[model samples]
Target: MLMAHPAVLRDLVEQYETLSALHAEDGSPESQQRLNDVAYTLCVSTGTRDVDAALIAARHHLPGARVEDDSVLDEEDTPKPPAATSAGAGI
Candidate 1:
């Protein structure tokens, strides 16, 4: 699996958290759309199946991650689903 740059993952995690804090999902259509876009990007970047898992994976890939910290593992320890394709996936 290809891993995203740590800086990029950090930015995505921060962006997603900020949007969530601002209640983007309950805000205007544009805000909700942006949140969804960010969530999807984060998921693809981390090879995770959902937003919650994506956040955890993103943090784990970031700098200073500890081996014993919030470790998540499946039976095979791999991404569960194939990721969706997006032109803006690098975002």
Candidate 2:
């Protein structure tokens, strides 16, 4: 994984900080996307498949940010259908 390289994670962290600052200052969705991408990559580096937990952890570790992981959003109440699998998925 790219994060195995010490510098890769550090570079992403720097980018995340910069983009997050821009998002906070101007409400730029593009900057938010970039920031989220960095967060996602950092989560993936941990080698866990539990994305929700990984995201929460990432938010907790974010520089100068205190994310509320306990709050439930209305959208989360909606039921999501199971993902469709390929024909050979269980073969």
Candidate 3:
């Protein structure tokens, strides 16, 4: 299961809607299609079928809107500790 903070989900939905509205008003079919693609991706990624519910939950958590950097930790940053073995054990 993909777990996402409520706020993140809301931001995506808001962006999707805004893009969709812009597409409709300007008769930009290509932009509208892109927005639809984004919406679909958000839904699938969040494991949510109800886009409205996801949007509401997201808005409640993230009102001001912000972007977060998701970077992977380096191997050096995650050094493994040495393992201990029995001093007197039959091999």
Give per-residue CA lDDT, model 3, range 1-91, as digits (tens). Answer: 7556765676687778888667653667787677767677676656667655455444444546433311222456654668987877886
Ranking according to TM-score, highest score first: 1, 3, 2
Residue pairs clashing, model 3 = none
Rank candidates by lDDT, best first.
1, 3, 2
Give each prediction's root-mean-square deviation over alpha carbons: 16.5, 14.5, 12.5
What tens digits encode model 1's per-residue C-alpha lDDT throughout 1-91? 8989999999999999999999999999999999999999998998888999999899988889987664677667754677687968778
Worst 10 residues of 3 by lDDT: 65-74
Stretch of 10 with least lDDT, candidate 2: 64-73
Local distance difference test, candidate 1: 0.90
Candidate 2 per-residue lDDT over residues 1-91, each given as its tens digit: 3323445545655666676666643667766666667777866864445535544444444454444434223476655678887978767
Report residue 7 deviation for candidate 2 (angstroms). 0.8
Number of the top-ranking candidate, with lDDT as the measure: 1
Q: How well does model 3 score by local distance difference test?
A: 0.61
